[model samples]
Target: MAYIRPLANGNFRADVRLKGITKNKTFSTEKLAQTWADSIERNIKAIPLMSSAQLLEITEADIESMGGEELFKQLGIDLFAIRHCAKLEAINALSKKELLQLTPQEIERMGGADLFIKAGKRIRYKTFREVCDEYLSRWGKKDYKGQMQRVDYWCQFFGDRIMTDIDIFDLREHVDDMIDAGDRATTINRKKAVLSSVYKFALSRGYVDENLVRSVVVDDDTKRRDRVLSDQERQRLIKACQVSHWDKLYLLVLMAMTTGARKGELMSLRWNDINFKDGTAFLGDTKNGTSRELYLALVVIAELKCHQEIGTGLIFPSLELPEQPMDFRAAWRNALKAANISDKDVLNTDGSVKLERFTFHCLRHGFCSALSDAGKEINQIAKLAGHKSIQTTMRYIHQGRDQKRQIVNELAQAFNL
Candidate 1:
C-alpha cells in the first residue's frame, strides 16, 4: 500500500510498503508525492506482467521527462514508441529523467536499449571525517571554520568509520559527555547544530537513510540569561559612551539600543542604509533573507549625520580595512567598564573566566523591554523588533535545508500574562 502524509512545513511524504520492504520519498507537493507513490506502486506490482500498456506509460513519461516532447512529436513515434517495446523486461531502474537523456537506441536497449546505470543507492563508503571534510569544503568563511572547530570532536570520535554507521546512540553519548565537561549550554548546542547540518547533507546525497540529527536533544539545564538593562544602567551606559563621543562603539551601542536589530545586521550596515530624510534604516542581508525598513528615531538620525560627513562607505567601517565592518569588542568592553556594568569575564571558583550578568546583546533586549514597559502591544513589539513569524515562510521558500534556523525570540518581546 502507498499513502501520502503531509509534513509540518507544507511538504509531503509518500510511503510505499510491500513485501516487508518500505521506501519513503518526500515531495514539495502532495500531487508529486502521490504521483511518485502511484508510479512506484504500479512498477512494483506490474514487474512480472510488465504490460505493454505499462511500458507505453513508462516510455511516454520518459519522453516527456527528457523534456523532448516536441522532438518526440516530430519523429511521429510519439504515439508509436510503446509498440516498439517488444522484448523490454527491465529499465535498469532508470528514472524517467535519466531515461530521457539516453539516445533512442540506448533507451531502446533499456526500453528493449542497454544504457547500463547500476540502479540503487551508490554508497560512497565515506568516513565521518571524510563527509565532514567534504561538507566543510563548501564554505571558506572564517565563521564557518570557527564553527567547524566547535564540532570537530565528532570527526575525531566517529573517526574512520562509515558515516552512516554512526547511530543516534553515538550522538547522544557525545552530547552527554559535553554536558559532563562543564561546557556552556550554548557551546554544546552549537556543536550539535553543526553536526546536524553535516548529517542533513549526508541524507540529501543518499549517504544516510535518515538524518539522525533530529533525534539529538540539548539536555543542558542552565537557565537562560534575559538581561534587559535598567533605566539607571541605560543612563550610565549612555554617559560612558558620551565620554568617548568620537569612538565608533558609542554609536554602535546607541544604534543597538534604539533599533533592537541583530548585532550582525548592525555590523553589516553602511552609511547609505541609515536615511536621514526618510527616517528609515533599510536592513538588507538579514539573517532571515527578508529585508526590513526600520523607523529610525530622529535623535539617531541626527547622531548618524555627524559621522556621515566623514565616512564614505560603512557606517561602522573597520579601522584597518575600510571594506569591512568594525569589530566593536574592545570598545564595547571599555565602555562597559567606564559605565560600571557588572557583566565581566570574572574568575570563578574553578579559576576559569565566567561571564557575568550582561553583554552587548542586552542593549537590544533593553530596547524591546523599554517599548514593552511603555505598554506597547505584543504584535507591535514584534513588528518593531523585526520578529514577525518567519519560521514557516522560510521553509516554504528554501525547502529542506537552511530553512530551520531557530532564531531566539528576545525575552523582552515575549508577552507576560
Candidate 2:
C-alpha cells in the first residue's frame, strides 16, 4: 500500500509500505510523489516473486518487464547476486577433483575462467611460472632477453601462484615493490606491460579470468624525458666524440644526432642497409616492428664514406667479437665527461641519477625538439622519428622558451595587435 500527504514545506511526501518493506520520499508535487510511491510499490511487489531459479532464467525482456535494473536495485533485489549464487550452487555440486580434471576446452565451455572465479571455484590452471615460460616460448622473439629477464623477476615473486589466483592487489603490491627499489616510471611501466601481456595471453587460453595488471597504476608524469641538447652542448659533445678513444664513437654520435635512430637500430646496421647514392639508411628492424628510411645529411654521408665497411657485416661491429655489437657504455660516459655534460650534480649520494640526465637517447629528443622549434609539422616530425603515434612524437618535442615567445609574437602580428 502507498499514501501521499502534503508536507508543511509545500512539498508532497510519499509513503510506500508493503509486506515487511517500507520506503518514503518527498517530492515537489503530489503527482511526483504518487508516481514515486507507485514505482516503489511495484518494485517491492516484483522482487519477492523473483526467486534464485527465476533470476537464473531471467532474460533481458523479463528484466525490462520488471522495470529494469534500477528498479531491482531499489527493491534490494540484486539479480546478478542471485544468478551468481545459482552458479555457485551448480559449481559446489561438482567435486574439486572433477573440476580439476576438466580440460581447458571443457572449462571454457562451462563459461570460462571468469565464470568459475565469480562462482568462487578454483580449477586446475597453469602456474604463473608455467604461463610465463609458455608466453616467452611463443611471443618473446621480438625482445627475448629483456622479456625473459622481466619474466624471471616476476616468477621470483609469483612463480608458485596460479595464474587465476593473482589478483589486481597482488599486481599493485609488485608495482609498489618496483617503486621502492628506485625503478624509473618508464622502466616500471615497461615491466607492467610485459606482465599485462602475459595475462592477456593467459586470458586467451582460458587460464585466467582477467588481466589484473591493467588496473595497476604507476606515476607516468616522470616518464617523459625532456633533455633536449642545446646547440653549444651538441657542438661540445660532437667535438668530444671526435677525440674519444673509441674511433667509431664520433660516427655513432653523429648518426644518432642526425637521423634520430635508436642506439639499437644504429648498432644493428649493416653495409647493405645504406644507399650512398640516395644518402639514406634502411632500418629493417625498428622498435615499432616496422621498417623506416633514415635520410643522411651530406656531412653524415661524408663521415660514413670515410668509415665504410666493405662486406654485408654490421657497420659497427664489436672490436673483440666481430659478430656482436660493441659495448660502448664506457666510451659514451667518457664522451659525456669530455663534453662537461655530466649528471654529477643530479646524482644521489649512492651514485644513482636523481633527475633526468643527458643520455644518447636525449639526442633523439633533441632531434624532435629542433624540428618542432623550426616550425615543422608534427606529422613530418613523427614520420622522420619513426614514431607510430603522434602523441609519442609530442613527448619528444620540448620547445625552448624563446621559441614559445616567438610563436606568440608571430600570432600577435598575424592578429595585427
Candidate 3:
C-alpha cells in the first residue's frame, strides 16, 4: 500500500511498499506511489490494475518535464536505479541527427543502447578447468574410464584459474612444458584433446568465441608405436604369476591381458556379471551404458575356477573394503617386486621382466596385440576392447608375434641359417 503525506514545507512525500516481495525486505516505489496504492487496493479486492512500472514507463518528454535529480527528490524516490533512469533520460535527449558523431566507446557507455548485445550471440570466455568441472558435474557418471581419471589431472593443472583469463598462448606454454619434459606425443595429445573438449562444450554454451586450442598444432609424430612383449618376456611373467602370493592379482592381470577389459571394469566386476558354465561375462554398464559380453579365455577361466569362493559377491573383493577390489597399487607394487621391475620398466602381460615404461594399461594392449597376431579383424578387436571407434583400437594392435618372428627368421634366412 502507498500513502502520500504533507511535508513541513508544503511538499508532498510518498511512502509505498509491496507485500510478499521477499521473506523480510519490502519493495518500495515512491515515484509511482499513487498508482502503487491503487494497485495494492485492487489486488486486495481481487481486481487487476496495470502494474506501477508499466504505468510510469519513463519517456523522453517525461524526463525533461521532471527536470533533474531535484524533481526526483521532490517525488521521494531515493533508489540507485533512478540514477540509471536519469542517465538514460539524458542520453535519449540526444537528437537523432547528432548521435552519429559519437565514438563507439562513447555510444557503448549509454547502457540502454547496449541491450541488444546478448541476442543471437554466445558467451565464450570460460577457462579450460572451469569447463572441465562443469562438464564433469553434469556428465561425469556417464564418462568413460579414461575420462574419469583425467579429472584429477586437469584439476591439478589449472583448477584455480578463471576460464575467461586463459588464452591460446597459455595453452601453448603448457603444451611446450609437457613436450620439454620428454612426454610422448600421445600423452601430450591426450591432454590437448581434453582441452579441445572443454572448448567444444563452452562453444555450445556460448562461453567461447572460438576453440583456440584446436587452432594450435601438436606434434603428432611423437606418438609411441605400441610395442608388444617378446615370447620370452611373456613366458617369464606367466612363470612369476605361478608363485605370486595374491592369486587374485595374477588373475586380474591375466583377465586384463586376455580380455582387454579396462582396469576399472575388471575391478568393478562381480560374480553375477560372470557365467562359468557358458564361459561368458556380461558387463551391464560399460563406458556408454551398453551391456557387453566377453568370452572368457581358457587361462582366465582356469584362474577364476581355481580361486572361486562362496563368501562374497565381488569377483575380486578387497582385503579392506571386502565388497570392493583392493587398490591395484598394493598388489602392483608386490608384482613389480616379484618380477624385479621398476616404474620405468614395463612388465610383460603376466607381470614378469623389465621391458619398458609401460604400466597396467599395457596389459590391455598386450591382449589386442595377441588377438591381432591370431588373425582377428580390426572391428572384432574394437568390440572386444570396448572402443567406440576402430581408430582407438588401432593403437592396441602392436606388431604381431608372427610379424616379429617373421622378421627374426628373415634375418636368419638372409644370413643363410
In terms of lDDT, the best-performing candidate is 2
Better of 2 and 3 by lDDT: 2
Query: For residues 50-125, could you state the per-residue lDDT of candidate 3 as single tens digits?
Result: 3446325756565434333333433444323443565656565766444434433454466523421322112232
Alpha-carbon RMSD of each model:
21.1, 22.5, 10.6
Q: List the candidates' TM-scores in order.
A: 0.55, 0.67, 0.61
- Best-to-worst order by lDDT is 2, 1, 3
Clash count list over all predictions: 5, 0, 9
Model 1 agreement with the true structure over 44-129: per-residue lDDT tens digits: 45443545575467665674443234533432333444553332324535455554444434433443222232233232356788
Model 2 pairs whose backbones collide: none
lDDT of 1 at 240: 87
> Which residue segments of model 1 deviate by more than 4 Å?
1-121, 129-161, 167-183, 220-223, 244-246, 309-312, 344-356, 390-417
lDDT of 2 at 222: 39
